[model samples]
Target: MNFTPLHRALGLPPCPLTDEILSDAVTSGVTETDDLDWKSELPPIKGLSQTDVPKDIAAMANSGGGMIVYGVEEHGKAATGRSDAGEFTEGHERAYRSVAVTAISPPVFGLEVHRLGTECRAVAVVIPASVDGPHLIYKNDFFGAPIRNDADTAWMKERQIEAMYRARFNERRRATEAVDSLFAEAAEGRDTVERAWLIAVAHPRVPGALTRLTRDEAREVFNDARTITLSFSKNTGIHPLDNVEYLNPRPGLRRWVAPNAATGDRSIWKESWVSVHHDGSVSLATAVGGHRMSSDGYWEGWQVEGRGVECAVADFMALIRAAARSLHLDEYDVRVGVEWSGEQPLSILTVDGSGFPYDGVSTPLRAFTSARSTVTASASDADFHRQTRELAEDCVNQGGITYLHVIEPLPEDEN
Candidate 1:
């Protein structure tokens, strides 16, 4: 997540921590900065409660987050060489995590700990810029917020603490508003469409590096989305950006819009379109209903296919993942919704096991005009797939679907 500014300087990514990168840092003599620290030894397990590991972590978290590399020796604050920190086992990882959880107030989440090297092992902890911060360190009767001061850790001053708290609250509010605003924006012209439209929206708690995108960059993101959609193990029904004739910028909203056709028109879902925003929020609006016409040529609305709804939601999750990676974001508040043309309860057509409509089984299994589900989760969580399935199911369940069978199937071992 670009935990350290040195990542850009050294042409390195802040992930997949490797021995080669460590060695290169030593050769380059990279010095400790506001977002990077080096240590020669692991914290002792015996007196772990009294160690500075928690403080270091809190400092980094309070100051835009960074990495703490244990096993790197330093001279005059510059990385000198790698040291033999001995074997790092699961015990070591848990020990460090425990200290972080217990010693810090409002425990920091989403820490990425990596074990590197073999004979002479090392550990790297990647901490995200927390939205819940101004994290306080309370141990042995000392309670105060710690922040990174360039190459040093220091106690946060009263003014700084106040500011951090304000920023934290403001961020929470903005994130909440952003999620709703993005969803409403995606559903802007939904009323005109005769068929049902599926909408997926995601807003990161801590915004990322995507302040804007050039025309080429916007096209590249679409290409990446196409690649990501294809790579998904689950089938996504909607090809969101497939038919866009232009990639246009909406400077007022600080986002780029790629609409399928009728670009100047206010109506959406004439065809599918996607919007990628500067704050790492993204959304997709696509029509999911096919022809349902009568012999008299009167406009008859069709039922939303259950499989297509599930697939579109699944693909939307994939797009969120891609956007998170591109923007270097982690946690997000995501929402999925289904909207129809009229207030009349719209039916959802269930599919059989063979991926076709069931024969002689009452076709419209569930009915609802609209359904929405929201979740706050980390994109990198191990349980992401399960969570996504649950979210998609929850959205449909409101409409009485009960379950989402078309999304990615869970492992047999998982509950």
Candidate 2:
């Protein structure tokens, strides 16, 4: 779990790697262990009996999780060849995930399915060790998925199964405690009763990933804040504060801010707040406390034009996307909520650009949830910007807002 699991499986170092990493591993040496495993070729997701993917995934999850590299040549436990993953189709990730979700009990979360760049076929499947485990293989491969025994996969013993079930309760208790104790400290000196807050909290369905991520890795992610942000129509925001020290209050937790606000204090959610957990979990929050403007660059209309709707949607999307890229995460579940200290806006409006009859209409906050990836995460990734934008458009369009303009400039202050 320490080396991004995917990187370890690929025989690369902890940080993101270049193609050279694979080349190096091929020549130098690559060995497998209980946590590291490999397959010569990715199996067809269908025809359950045709693939051993279930067994390999189950084995890793049952044994505290690890990475399984698919489509590579291996001799003994070592990776001996080139990108075998290239053989897989785009649908492979989805197919394997469908099986993983249903085949394993207490479903695994945060499963990272990524191929290096756009060219390589070598896919890395990172299965996180679950706190709710001994994930039984409930489907086709075996009598349930087997656990890793030495360098091999084996069925879990009765005693091990019993232990996992018992620990499930403790796991739940720890999570509850984490929120109870950390909730207050989450804001700490940064809390202000006068300022309204928008908090985005991400709690991992799979725990313990953070213990594997080093302090250095967290810092590395923080350093990228300068460039990770919202960009639209020649406007860019959310740059990291210069000379900002990395915030590591406790293990598996870190915080940092985006630029110095007028108050010179970037600790609170006024401008932007970025959080990270050792388990590869992260969250972000921003406050709409100060002077603000509307989507079309207006400052006074909080309700009449329904400008805040577009403004809020754009900001939330920007924050989430920035958080994901900074944490080195491909996909994760995030919940975004608004804590209004001031009068809540009547409702968010959905509007297309020029001529939309019902431009100002009642729209729920939930409309923005569908979009996951933003333009900032990776512009090169296929449909990167459209993935999240499309969902937003569909949600609003359903309400008769035919056109959706994504780049809503922050509203100006009334003063």
Candidate 3:
């Protein structure tokens, strides 16, 4: 296989060679072969003295790169023949790790030792060039010394040591340039945020009716949809209704219940508050005379039709959805539902003319108003009341028109 400059410099294949190919090469006396510059065989010297291994390692690392095949013969012209000789076994792998740790200076970091097939007869030491410096093999006499010349390893001369250091500096400079180029490309918008949403019309348990929306489209839906029913609890926070809660009450009933109730009887009162808080921030408290009044327990001592409550809720949701779509958020993040203030009773509508058939009778919609003082602690009473009154008026005028224009029911296919 073709080898990269880095690989050849390390004295190994570009990629790992199979044990079979390695064994065959060794048996064929390929160890004696020379690359354009250096020999591929282990030096005749037995048990590389702790000092020499580092120098040889450094030279191989610094020189364009070559592999040092251990346990093989370096015959000049022909096969010098094989011997059991200083073979490296599994134990040698561990020993090499130690040798790298103690002997080499500035370290040969990515060194790998591979056993060559069956007899443990051959081994290869792969050492990558150091990006740091001309490695010094700590010898007894010479102290910090480099490999002399590329030929049979000897003590390094002063000039050779300087050249090696220069090469290292150049490698680091090149690496920095490469990194800068990468950063420049990234900054130019090669990478960006990707958003996705899974909008399922039918529940997850059912199949064939799921729809998926991409980021831009979902954002459009969120920004344009009218009347969003978001459930927000200062305690629990806003979230989609859980499946059990979503399924327990019939869609019409669920639509009617306060957005805060999870199941029967339980109310999320203390945990929440609601406000229009838009550019034209408005609120409707129980005192106003419609559905909001009926729900808030402040009726004018007269009964109102349940359809009024349904229509108001549907209208509110339609407005929220439109606002969310205009804001460009995904539908998955938007939800709509009735709100309950635990401060008062929550009511359910009955089929018969009898008012509030549920165990907890509902208050009048008028009692529930747009007044901020009733919903928020920090809001001024007068300001809250004014905002609520304005909001009630807007809901009646602007919100009512917008709802009629957008929320008409779709015609069903009879086929």
Candidate 4:
């Protein structure tokens, strides 16, 4: 999807997405709309207590969010004619953030300001539609919530503001539902019942109102065969669908669906599968059946191939990097949950963690769950390697037996 030509056709303006897109908008002959606005200059930041700039931002976000192009002066409503009003200053990004933090009530997230166009003649502020919005411009002795109205800014009516507050919950629910629906649909018609699966889902705290990538572009992205990493325990057997790798699958969707195949065979379960959404959300999953030893010992009790943690840190980093690149995101603030289920329960006490292809363990160890614990860390900070050590705190009394059981039970009240 080449937006460069589309921008030329519609005459858009500077946007936070890219310089080329903004250039096309500038020449598109598009006039100012309720969600679009142009300014002759960046907001002055000489210790000003408050300015209309923050209100301008509130108006756009309150009206479901849009871009504010500073330094380009519109000629009437049509932008058929315009000029560079001013140049970007060094500390302006900080100032823009300040406005959101200090002047706007309830603040906003993902408010980004970028210098755009040739020779830095323009600046664009991209405000993502927020789930926690109806942002008010709060300055000394005044309380105002702004809304955009047909190329103009206006104050929101009391009822409308109240409605915005009430709608917040529904919007959040819809956003969450949308991501869950994506995961459900991505695995459609697949037989994951007998296999173990790792499913990871992420959504930006602020809404991702991004332009969709073209199928051609997505194909180009998935062309890197390494994008879908494949690893299995030496004992794990794989089905012969090696030739099946990637697919576009449908129209108007620039997504990369990995390990491309139509079969539901458990052999392919050892490999990773990815689903990239147009709205910048991503889901990565791998399904495999591995063997879990029970009290029955090394002879085996519960067996499923391609299960258990193997190369977890490396695999996860690769998946996250690939998702981020495909979705065009530079940072991630997401909630992640892992659900691992298989044809049989892992008989932990009998099986040795050392196994065939050693991913990490050097000795035979069996772990049994006695209590549930929540481990928390930033995506930047935690990994299975690091968190495993922290989780060891609960099993210190296992001693030299190479087994895990709760050493300290949490209080009943805490539980």
Candidate 5:
């Protein structure tokens, strides 16, 4: 439930945007900016397909994303009054999505459409700042990337387009590097014990304005996150924050660390921990496997339980969503990896009677394997589930477990 820039500008509450907020924005003399636009009305469905909806959306995305509010009359880019844009049905919302997809190139992801007011509804289209830009809008015979120029929409020139392409590539590289760095940091000191680690990291492209929190406040917010049951081949009830009992601040990293390191033998890598950063980033690691003892009690290679990986992914995604909400962030780039140290390859042990694994799935590992993807905190439950499953599948598949299905469809009511 990340609030839009417009919400911040208007000094409105961060959630449940309504007509009162819109009216307050107008009365307070709020005007259009590079990230905010106001519209008096919307065209008919046919006209909307060919009108400025796509252009405005593209411009906002290119200009670091913002909101386009309909039913707000404006003069000289200054808010004038609120007018009824008319009722927006589910079909109408779908029409807007369809137009954005068909009319814009490299369609923007994480677009949110909100209906405000009960009697006289106003529509708000929130576009996320995309790493996939520059997004183009096609005219009759030509296509041009639209950019927000001050308070208006403008076409991108040749040099601006080139710079955008460069920026896009750099963003991708940085995201990959960030994931690798975080994984390496978490994996440190693991060599002291024989264990397979599940490490996950969530990094925001444009970092949030999350201020530092006291250790007490940090503990309360994290512990309060809901523990939802993720249904896969089995039901794994996990909440990343709830897994750890002890919490302490790591001021050097500007984060709070919660680890269940064994008190008796600190060298043993039987630990589950989560690190929440001030920049709205989070890193979590949980040990799913330890020394596999033979019948004679001899140590064998690491054997990772397949169900542990599934449960870890479920907990990771849930915690990520909670962190995003707390920091008022929308989009994040996420990475997950499994690491173990040994000459022999790690084994993903299947349940004895589940029939989900075979002998050939376990192969020799060089060191570690990982997968990365992007997620929107405010996305629909189905999309969130799909993204989490895809990331988990990629990580497991790298270890030769191809048939792992980590996320199941949400219940009807939840959908």
Candidate 6:
């Protein structure tokens, strides 16, 4: 019933380890050998029967957090090379889940099943150390209690069982203390929007450089600014076009801009946008809005992906109209134009006599694109901006679009 019961049930730390880290652990001898578990001597069976697997599971829980790499060669020490690695053999994963749910004494949760790779040669199951100690594995006639001893599993004795009970009590006390501490820390900063922004801004899987901006500068660009232009030098690693900027107007009112290009000088080019929100949300809304608006003749003809210049212009106009309807703004208030030939990834040029520019404003128009790019808006504004900029640059480099412009959020006072 807690906020994240699944995570709690699994007894894993708050952070989820990356696939690489998990993979490395499995490959580095986490898989059992004959010297370790009796199950290892039983050969790499297609699937666990009721009897063979329960003891291994109990032993693993009693031992410590470790992995069981099934379908792997015991002596070869290599993966199976099957196409579906971890996928259950017909009823394997299901059987594992079902047995874990019903057969284990107190129940174990948070068992993850995943495909290793293209080759279904191996399956790995991570078992957490049981605080309850020495679990009984009852499968038909075979009944035994087992405990973990360092790297090996051993049968449990009466004295060992009693000691395990005492240890279990101690573990419960420690677990309660740890959980309380974690809850307190999580509660300390309840800024969902800010957290979401950070998630948005952070680099995706690939490594890249980071640039920091002061809070004062962020406020200056976001507030009292008619238009904000972002430029970035090209790099192999993706970089956000605009740096991180925070816009926290009031309680429950915040917006983060991920990397994006507002405009460029040329009428023909491609552009992209990415948005991140505080609650671990991400979206990738490309130049579809611009394409929609331009196609409808709401703006001048400009080059866009997968469409001719005139068609692109018509689409861009249609996008502006759509954004107006969705964002509750007037088409007349929205300014549409293009920019190019600047140091920035995308240069934004607002239409003259089209009312105040919403190019850089953290209004619903920009927010819509951000939300479209990364559907989660519970992230911090700064992080979202950072991510959006990077995505914009990536789009430009990939020939998606050349110019970026605002198509909605027309000023309230515009004609």
Top model number, lDDT: 5
Candidate numbers, best lDDT first, in rank order: 5, 1, 2, 4, 6, 3
Question: Across residues 78-166, which tens digit of lDDT does each residue of candidate 5 receive?
Answer: 99888899988777888888877788988876677788887666888888778878999888998999999989899999999999999
Which 10 successive residues of model 3 have the least lDDT summed? 197-206
lDDT, candidate 6, 264-365, per-residue tens: 533212333332222211122223223223343432222232122212222222222222222222212111122222122332222224532233421111
Every model's TM-score: 0.73, 0.57, 0.38, 0.60, 0.84, 0.35
Q: Would you list the C-alpha lDDT of every candidate in the order shown? A: 0.69, 0.50, 0.35, 0.50, 0.72, 0.36
Residue ranges of candidate 5 with Cα displaced over 4 Å = 1-16, 213-226, 229-242, 246-252, 261-270, 291-301, 354-361, 405-415
Which candidate tops TM-score?
5
List ranges where model 4 is wrong by over 4 Å. 1-31, 74-90, 112-114, 117-120, 185-195, 203-216, 223-256, 260-269, 278-281, 288-415
List clashing residue pairs in candidate 5. Answer: none
Model 2 lDDT tens row, 1-415: 1365436556555676445565566555577778877676677667643367667777887787787777667787777777646655657667777777776675655576656535655776778676667676654454654888877888877887888778877876665555434334444544334553444444443433333445565555554432332443112222222223444423433433333233453333225555556544455444433323333332222222222223344444444444455544433343443343234342334434452323355553322232222122323333444544443454445334544454432233113
Clashes of each: 0, 16, 63, 12, 0, 84
- Model 5 poorest 10 in a row by lDDT: 291-300
lDDT of 4 by residue, 338-362 (tens): 2333334432221245444222222
Question: Model 1: how large is the Cα RMSD against the reference?
Answer: 5.7
Q: Cα lDDT of model 5 overall?
A: 0.72
